[model samples]
Target: MSILINIEDLLSGSIVEGTRMEFKKGWNPVPIMRSICAFANDFENEGSGYIIVGVDEVDGKPIRPFEGFNPTNLERVEKELVGYCNLIQPSYFPRLSLEAVDGKHVLVIWCPAGANRPYKVPDDVTAKHKSYNYRIRFRSNSIIPNDEQTTELIQLTAKIPFDDRVNTFASVTDLSKSLMREHLQETNSKLYEESEEMPLEELAEKMNLSQGAKEHLFPKNVGLLMFSRKSQEYFKGAVIELVEFPNGLENPYTEKQFEGTIQKQLIDVLAYIKTNVIKTKVIKYTDREKSDRFFNYPYDAIEEAIANAVFHRNYELQDPIEIRILPEAIEIISYNGADPSLKQTDFDKGRVRARRYRNRRIGEFLKELRLTEGRGTGIPTIVKSLADNGSPVPIFDANEPERLHFIVEIPIHPKFIEQGNNQVSDQVSDQVSDQVISIIKYCSSPKSRQEILNFLGLKNHSMNFKRNVQPLIEGGYIDYTIKENLKDRNQKYVATDFGKSVLIKIE
Candidate 1:
């Protein structure tokens, strides 16, 4: 495998320490080996991570670049680190290279993602290694999963959705009767008034909180999420972690983690985003536009995306569904990908619907709560609402794009969204050919691929549109008004901020 990071950037002090990259002042045999193990078994990470021994990390930023390794002893360090990699229980071998950063000698260890995952430190290696055996990288640190976390990870081998399975460790008493009664009232069923008087055991069973009958029973993940006071106790990462990074990616302007009932978490997260992250823009009233009030994104779109994350995310993976708010966009990230037998491109246009659900039981419950349609309307609702609000096309970015992780990124609105936007950077204009620019300019408003062809006084050439217009869409210079409805005959394209930049460049 190739080296995980750019040597030039590291020398220039551009890359720093984080989940995927780490820098050290000097080679410490034990800690360096532990980090290597963590990087190898990076289940939640996108790609493999890199370790640079030479730079000092301060305040979460790499600084004070130094000669990382002793040049005369560099070969010896390599031999020792390689030995450590071999000593890992599952065995992790990294690409060891001796390179120079700013004339300072440094050793770069490129740790590849583990082929045999969930690697552990060998018991015979050392007591330090044994004590901190199976390690996973969280942020920048190699963390030991506590007893509950270990149990949680092991229990996921059944490959069932957490909400669908019975919680073997939790008993019927763990689920609160009051929470069940409140849930019944929220449903507004004819059974609502009667549910208060109903025995707790029957109520629990009715909610599918347990298996079997009166005597033998246990709480399910869904029951804990909805009924338990500390649902996060069992479902560790079920919380919604909201962080607004106004200053930069590394700096958080505000941060909050919401936990409780699944539905409550959803509601509170939506409220928090609307109150804090949602920005209102005032436009000078014009003859063309009457409304003065314009929000950064549609409220409904935000709600749909968050609700979908809660209902659809793999709760077996111990990572909170993270909502990151920034000036440019709002990113709602869920752990793991959806099941698709097809190739990555099959879901690229966002049309592939899984034949079954990863969370069927939880989905059904959300439907009863009126939180979601449970008809796969989650994505459609998010896409339509954003488009209606004059936002850029919503994107579902995934690390394994073909695997289908649900990551809804809703870009904050630029001015004049429906007609497209105000001018953007000319970076894309320089990237495209003259033929593409003309088609974009001709689209004063939204235009179809065929309409543009007619405007250009050319007969239909399917390949020509694909070659010219398709690139524009991919470059983020232009977008379809109805991205989810790409098959629609009336589907039209409009220039984005970046697209407008291309037009201004042409002018």
Candidate 2:
């Protein structure tokens, strides 16, 4: 089976971290088995790791002029690997691929987090007298877990992350071949080439997106979320709902819902926000060569906040990820907050880190799609983005104690806040001067245009109407009673709920 990631990216250490990858000059059965076992343990919940044989290493990185494996021994090595893997207590087998790097063959082992974990293997696979122990990856080395760590590992028995667990309700057909191909193509994976000809089950197996016995295959939760367009059917509230409260929640508001593959929804929602909400302002300075340029709310901060919400949210919840654009801040809310290990104090001090990710497989797909940087970078990225834009410090609330919900409230830039205040002041000033407030008050009960003109002591000319009542209608202070027939002789205007709120403010 082909590895889901680009082989070149793996070799260069561009996408995968050093701790998750190891380079071996040649295969030595015992050490390879230990590394494989450690990777299967996945001590940090950082997802599966890779082992590259036939590459010399120095300081934990691949060395150039690799000592490639002898191609003639490929069959014998495969047989040996299978034999050693059988020594694992639960009979775990990692995916292996053979590729040529710089005119020489190398063995790539993809050891995903095992289903039945806390796997143990004999110290020496060839020994008749064997000692078995559980091994885990620590940074770059495989080590036997201490008693405390061993107990923790044991607790994770048969406890695959929610995203990685096979969905008994979903079949392999639920995963879209097109979506899988698109993702493979986007990541530049070689799997994309073979995807067209491969059956759905085979392709899913190659991507590690399915599990169970060969006869009764089921798609994993991550697979459905990433590939199925109708993800909400399976995972309730697998959508984003964006609400804009331009005039406060008490008044009229606009809303939009984004649904699709999680990555697609993320992209669409971000684009919608950028075009509709994000505003750039320039302040010229006499003392400096460059003008001050910043956004109302930095795009980076918003992007990371929203992406993190999707990555960490509980898919089982009925609450959609929500983005509320209020006058002073944008609140990104999701259900079932941070991991239990993270305290409220951690969120308060911006030291948010996950001991175990709620959705490891989702995070992996997002990282591959370049939608997020996994491994606890989301909070810091947001903080830096806000700081750079001179926006107010973001509020991170993990709904302490129970952590029933998570909220990231990013304040609007101070300049934008000031500008909003000034605009309100200007609007009030304009209304007072134009005598439109009186017109609105007069129209509390729907009144004809003639009655309004007579009340305002204004002429009935088009310019007079445009200057007086038209502004009120356009400002949302009043609406036409006969809105569908604007030119109807019986058309009348009445105060809107928003207009009543405005009167409360100004009165």
Candidate 3:
């Protein structure tokens, strides 16, 4: 078992804090349920996260080591959590554990990435009374859900099996011997050498590629996909198209169509990306001495994104994988839609961290070739790399029903110098401000406090905003108006002329 992380380590930011402990004098199922959902959602959005329950906070800071909850009580709390999970739809339970720290029991709930892509709370009392929701935030204090988040959660709960599970009707002759030989070479030749004398049927069986009983297993489509030289011949949608555009999004400066086996196509595509994408870094200098500095787009992130597109793509969609490269960003779009098991908001929270390959055979083969690190680390790695590089977080948007798009924008670092008229910062900021302004403008009508929180990625900071929005209202930049349907007197905010003016100035 992973050691229970130290309280200080957790408090000092070693772990991503979701909801802090609210030590109410009495146990309340609603708050606990909300905390579990929030924390689990956070883990799903972020990866390998924690929900530290025990410590008390005052004014948003940990005030004292928890004087509440003893060991017996902690055990009772754990049992209650388990009961809560059992009641949830599809179940929102994590692998629950208890840690004793400074004589107080801290509940550490570890929510592993769902094998089913998305996990949802089943229709129980909690699900019925409370809305099915996920949370995210921009600043730090608000927690809110939007239509997009609700839709995403619902979509995630719907089951969509990996593409490889679909049986294809192709024969062993469809298998590419050359590709088989290459796979052998790439994976250290052990499997290839052992299977050399065996018949194709025997080989398929030995490799565990056959699905059902050996007698009924027809090595048609599976063989073609696994070993065929021209895999695209058997599966037309298996190819990847990599296009590098010039300065703008108009015509492509260079475009290459990669066909044949997935492995071969991936190798070729990555090589193409490395050659075409220009990477630059910033170097800092002292008053006298200069230091060597080098920075480039993270190879791991790019590779993972590409690998994910190829492996997780929905070949059944009959759309080709497309990689578009521009001066500012690289977009990888796969014809398949978002993982049915994960919500879009969960991506921002770093909540899930288990790899669920749409093509199990392809995933296994790629793992053997050392093309990808198994265990669902690809997305996290991509997010982390972008964060480290000082680039905006990559966006993963679902085009619905058909396509999953990933856009990675590589900004020119502020330190890099250009020839004439090098005002990249102003240009980029202006673009970002425009985007932010557009969102603000769209919410012009009086929205619920939740609506604004969702719009600004401030779901985690809802309470803070509840306290702060009044000041903005008092300042006359925004005003609160009551909702027509709701009985609550508390009003949501509408951007005032002043707010609009501020936006216009920035734009």
The lDDT values for all models are 0.66, 0.82, 0.54
TM-score of 3: 0.48
* Candidate that would win on lDDT: 2
Candidate 3 residue lDDT tens string, 38-118: 444432233333444565656545546564455567668767778877655457656544555676666555543333333
Which residue pairs in model 2 clash with each other?
Answer: none
* Candidate 2's TM-score: 0.81
**CA-RMSD of model 3:** 22.9
- Comparison by TM-score, 1 against 3, better one: 1
Put down candidate 1 lDDT per residue, 1-507, tens digits, no spaces. Answer: 123233654443333225567788887767777778777765442344678788777765667646467778877876787777777876777776676557777777777555466677753354453543777776678777678756644443334455657788888888899877665555444345556677777777655567655677777777887788878888888888988887658754778888888877776666555444565554543344444545677777888888878877888888899888876788898877655542345446655554435675566556545566534456677778877877788887655645535577888877523443343222121334445567667766898878877877754554335434665676677799898989798889898887788668656
Candidate numbers, best lDDT first, in rank order? 2, 1, 3
Minimum summed lDDT over a 10-residue window in model 3 is located at 424-433
lDDT of 2 by residue, 1-507 (tens): 567778777888767778889898888888889989998988777887889999998898788788988878878988998999999988889988887678887888989988889899888888889899999988799899999999999999988888898999988898898889977877778778878899988898889999988998899999999888668889878999999897767678888898888887887777556545777666665555666667778888999999999998888788899999998899999988778898878777776778877787888788876788857678899999999999889999878778888899999888765644322222222123225557768888999888888887864544346545665675678898887889999888899998888778676
Predict model 3's lDDT versus the native: 0.54
lDDT of model 3, residue 74: 60
- Which residue pairs in model 1 clash with each other? 54-68, 344-402
**Which runs of model 1 end up more than 4 angstroms from their true locations?**
1-160, 286-289, 341-347, 401-406, 416-507
Question: Which window of 10 residues has the lowest lDDT sum in candidate 1?
Answer: 422-431
